[model samples]
Target: MVKIYYYKEDDSPMTAPHDSGEPVAAEELEKLGVFYKYIDSQASVDNLATERQYKNRDYITLDGATFPGGEEALNAKLDVFFNEHIHEDEEIRYIIDGTGYFDVRDNNDRWVRTLVEKYDLLILPAGIYHRFTLTDDKFVKALRLFKDEPKWVALNRIDGNTESNEFRKEYFASLSS
Candidate 1:
């Protein structure tokens, strides 16, 4: 089952609900902006080739079925987009392959790094400064889903305190490990 964290206009900032640990049906996926889908690792590999062919990038081969370039491209195309800053609306995503990291600042002022892999899902509410990075040699893909259709916004260039940014530091530590 897909877990959803619903927030009304008057509700407080929300956190991702716990997963029911059940598989999501395809029919339900159409309604929600985010849902998880699991594909055989081998099938994921084949799909990558197909995607590359469709994009006319034959020279590019996906490593372990991960498509960071594709994800980045799709994200770039979204109406509102930003990196390293807080967003104004809830952002959701479903991991479709490999693994990726989401760095988030919780209400407690503690930074949290969530490691998402195939079939994992994530939801981030507004006003949380976050960033994403893919692990090397990990072929990961995810659907960038959003509640607001026109949610892309470019963040102004600003720096946050690295030490205070717990999520960011934890993610970097994982890379080194």
Candidate 2:
């Protein structure tokens, strides 16, 4: 079962639990326009993508720089992933295996950490400020789905450039309603 809790602010590593352990209901997440679903892990990826109207898809295995550039590259990637950012399109990720955390900002601008496991599918509305990190195992394999050509861009919240974005404006408006 996927679960969410309030995130604890601390100087611990990104992979640290940093969990307040205070559970948050699924409806609370949905109220922020963050949708979730669960598809059998054995289900066909192509079928799922088609049904969801996803135009492009790929797999990413995050297991300590096991791909290409080695540990240094993996470190760089983690830095990017852990940075609070927003996307121009809905960010969809399906956990194929392992576990990870997706920390999303709530209406009150607090962190809500959700632990995602196998078969879990998260559909984060476009422009939602969020970030991700792996659990202590430091491993997770996920299917990344996109509506069009993959947008691998992340407008980091620290830069203050995401405020005027159209998708972001629309997302915030939906929250008020």
lDDT of each: 0.44, 0.88
> What TM-score fits each model?
0.43, 0.93
Lowest summed lDDT window (length 10), candidate 2? 40-49
How much does candidate 1 score in TM-score? 0.43
RMSD of each: 14.8, 1.6
lDDT of 2 by residue, 110-148 (tens): 999999999999999999999998887878999999999
Candidate 1 residue-wise lDDT, 1-177, digit = tens: 323221122332122322233433434323222223444464664464354342221121224333456645534522132255655554555566666555554334433445567766565544455655554443455555443354555332265444445444443353345
Task: Show the colliding residue pairs in model 1.
Answer: 1-22, 66-139, 66-140, 80-151, 80-152, 80-153, 81-152, 81-153
Candidate number of the best TM-score: 2
